[model samples]
Target: MPIFRPYDTPRDGAPVLAAGGVSRRRLPLNFSEEDLPLFEDALEAAIPQTRLLELEDVGVSPEGMLFKDWRILPESFSSPSIMEQFLDRRRSVLKFLAANYLLRRRRKFGRDCLWIVDDWSAGYFHWLADALSRLYVARDAAKDLVLLLPHRYRQLEFVQSSLKAFAVGSVEYAGAGEVYFCRKLFMPSHVAPSGNYNEEVVRGLREMLVGFYGREGAGSGAGERVYLSRGRAPKRKVSNEGELLDTLREFDFRVVHFEDHPFEEQVRIAAGARVLVSNHGAGLTNILFMNPGGRVLELRRRDERERNWFFNLASATGLEYFYQLCDPENPDEGPHTANLIVDPQLFRENIRLMLAG
Candidate 1:
């Protein structure tokens, strides 16, 4: 039996591609002065430097767990702390042991390969902001390497369209329940922490995707006003969405259900939006495609203050960030997944202020 290390051995000489810096969140227009202390840390945070390293004889599990020399790599998990907790739980030790030792059936890639797939790669927001951001950072290095992804992602339209947009040359997928052994793995450090973002890398991603999908003179007007609807989702819906939709219509906001459209259409819609309104959800991730100086008004649950993913995104992409806290229809359902009950009057006031600026 072998023990797992939270991270790989420090590669002090790893190539640093992008330098880290401070990222500041622009407070919402109607932000309360009394709550400033609640968001002080997230208001300004340090971004980590991006690095590219080469690892030999690395083994990757189906969930994108990376291990070499009996030590797990931090890149396999969302963060090192999460890896520590995973080890604490001891739930996957037998599987890990089997994959590294007794698992005789393994797929071998005998070339310089790039591994950007992670546990969260299936989600749209993480796919764009996390996985693709790594690919963008390793664009030059990946030219000659085979990009490895999970087989399940092969059929996702956004995944295919985005890879095509990036013009990634070589790609191969590792099957489920199979351990992959790469002779030489070219791994790029995450562009930034989970919620924190790196301005340069994010802006670079936006420019690349927008260039691929943006049409001439499209989204160039005062810009399209958009309201993203989460009506199809099982939870976290706007309980008073009908009244809000009426208000949104008054402002000429186009109601968009992102799932109804294709990936390219979503990109175009995002590129054209000068103003975007949505409850806190993955749909807001499209802000990455909007032009700089655009505005976003997020409807948040009053108790859910710490999840600042969209706020950090807006800051990174130069979008005006605004928010209105609403009460939860089912407070017992918890903050992240609770349905929101918004006051139409407050929403109107916030919209007016957002548009005026």
Candidate 2:
């Protein structure tokens, strides 16, 4: 790695070129581990000499987790910084990611292919969309643009939105200029297995699993559920960690609190759990990798919403699903007990049904 200067999109200090004018702009290729196996396979089959950079390694997220708490990017591309400062100590994780991948596009492998994997849901969508837009803009001289997204149907919908945007229009930010989108080379598929994953990736995942289990052992239930809600952010926004914690406490069964874990970790955690529950959120896409006979419960906001994603995932993995309703009376308004929102009595009954099968 030559440690080139970071790509200054905001033009904080140095001179930057215009998009349609061309002065040398940065292009990012983002993907995720959930899409790894399929992405790698497709890339190798299509362009095997391509180099890869884990967005986490270089520092980026699909939903812009790195940009949280700031308004540097527009709302669609906006994100909450994943990094948290504990007791005013160290910079958060997102800061580290931004610093590392900011402007340094390293040359790895032999090809010019730069593979970026989005570990956080919705975090990488804007980046992927913007990069595609750039490629499309530079189409006269642009090289091939390849994108790998999770193959599952749920994830496909998000990718589809970006691709549609690329084919039709570009999204513009105040300082960042217009981002073009292209449907042709922006391939969305399943995750391909890694051939050269670092020791840290493996070790960290294991530690995460251990930590998850440790929490499970200490909690009321011996199980974990990855709650998937719609969009990248939670619809019913609660204030502070205490309110969310209070929401989780309302459920009667022993449930491990699993929020904002990476897609890979979600799979690892779901596989180890006896039951998995989600609210038709994007994270439910990970259920495709859950253990056979693993249980799933979905809480839908409305009755008519389509969940072919859930159906396909549950069918493929053989995980049982128990769909329940969010108490209309509670209406997810204000701060109410989790039990009232979910109706603990009904939730327990559904869990019983899942266990029965």
Candidate 3:
């Protein structure tokens, strides 16, 4: 049965593990009355129920696609809205058909398994904020539940450490170019809409992670400022980072690259930050670990005002949020991937204002 509108479909037989409701977020400090309409939908969005779906004889792909009897299950993709937003319809259809029809090798598992992998599970930001957050809802079953993951994901250190922290029973990997058939599959609905957050669930997950990995007295002290650098990134490079770094240094800011550190180390570094400064990117996702009331300064592209993932997160986590709009080096490259140019003088002004309050 192909579910085209999984969001509207009633949970006739599925059990509601975590109830859903509406949540409100405070607007970013820089937001004005004119920008209210732009964020109207997000300011108070409805969170979806975290329900458990029990399916028999379901075929699972390495990319987290699920199907039964050669038919796709839209709910397995998280939500129909996310599918339409991030995936190419024609390409997805072709891939699904090829996986079920052309692929011959299939591995069958008779034991019930829990599947949480999704299309965006590979990326660091989505892995933590979206994929792993689902565990919070399914935590009640974490004791003996076997998590199914892609073959390559089994080698990622962060993934391994996170699973350990969650106390998941065991893990199974789905091989590339082959579909695994599960006799019984246990899947959970998304805890929140993609890029949106549920404060209680998200904060709870963050606390659990910190409690497990956090070191005592790590990155401690007031007036401890940190700058997350995107210097190694292919796109979204800060053209004038050297100049910006010089100014940041005057204020005792320590610049670091999150990619260089282990998952636990990243948590420790973020734990003591009184202020965090970084361009709008995945590195900012670490704000979830920071102490509440800490300030966040996001160097956002002027045209990319609607991408408020970090803003909403700061609010949900009880952090004060602020943003400084920077110009893209090449506007033709587009807001999402274009390099940015930060004005050091403007940054100084913003920093002073942030510290004053």
Candidate 2 regions exceeding 4 Å error are: 1-254, 260-264, 327-340
Task: Please give, for residues 1-357, the per-residue lDDT of candidate 3 as tens digits.
Answer: 233322232357888877788878887766657656546666877887788877788887776777765556765564566666534465667666675667657888887788776777777788889888887778778667778887789788888777878767788888876778899878777778777887888889889888888743664474368899999998887988999877887888889898899888888778768789999888898998887898999998876746788888898899998877888998888876899999889899888878888
- Give lDDT tens digits, candidate 1, residues 189-299: 888888778899989988998888884247356338999999899888898899887789899998999999888889988898889999998889999998899899998
Which whole-number lDDT from 0 to 100 does residue 339 have in model 2? 23
List the pairs of residues colliding in candidate 1.
none
Q: Write the per-residue lDDT of candidate 2 for residues 166-221, one digit (tens) a residue.
A: 32323211112111121222211112112111122222333333443333233444
Question: What residue runs in model 1 are displaced by over 4 Å at the alpha carbon?
Answer: 215-223
- Which pairs clash in model 3? none
- After TM-score superposition, what is the CA distance of residue 71 in candidate 2 from its true location, in Å? 30
Best-performing candidate as measured by TM-score: 1
**RMSD of candidates 1 onward, in order:** 1.8, 18.4, 2.7
TM-score of each model, paired residue for residue: 0.95, 0.36, 0.91
Evaluated at residue 271, the lDDT of candidate 1 is: 90
Ranked by TM-score, the better of candidates 2 and 3 is 3
Whole-model lDDT values for every prediction: 0.83, 0.34, 0.79
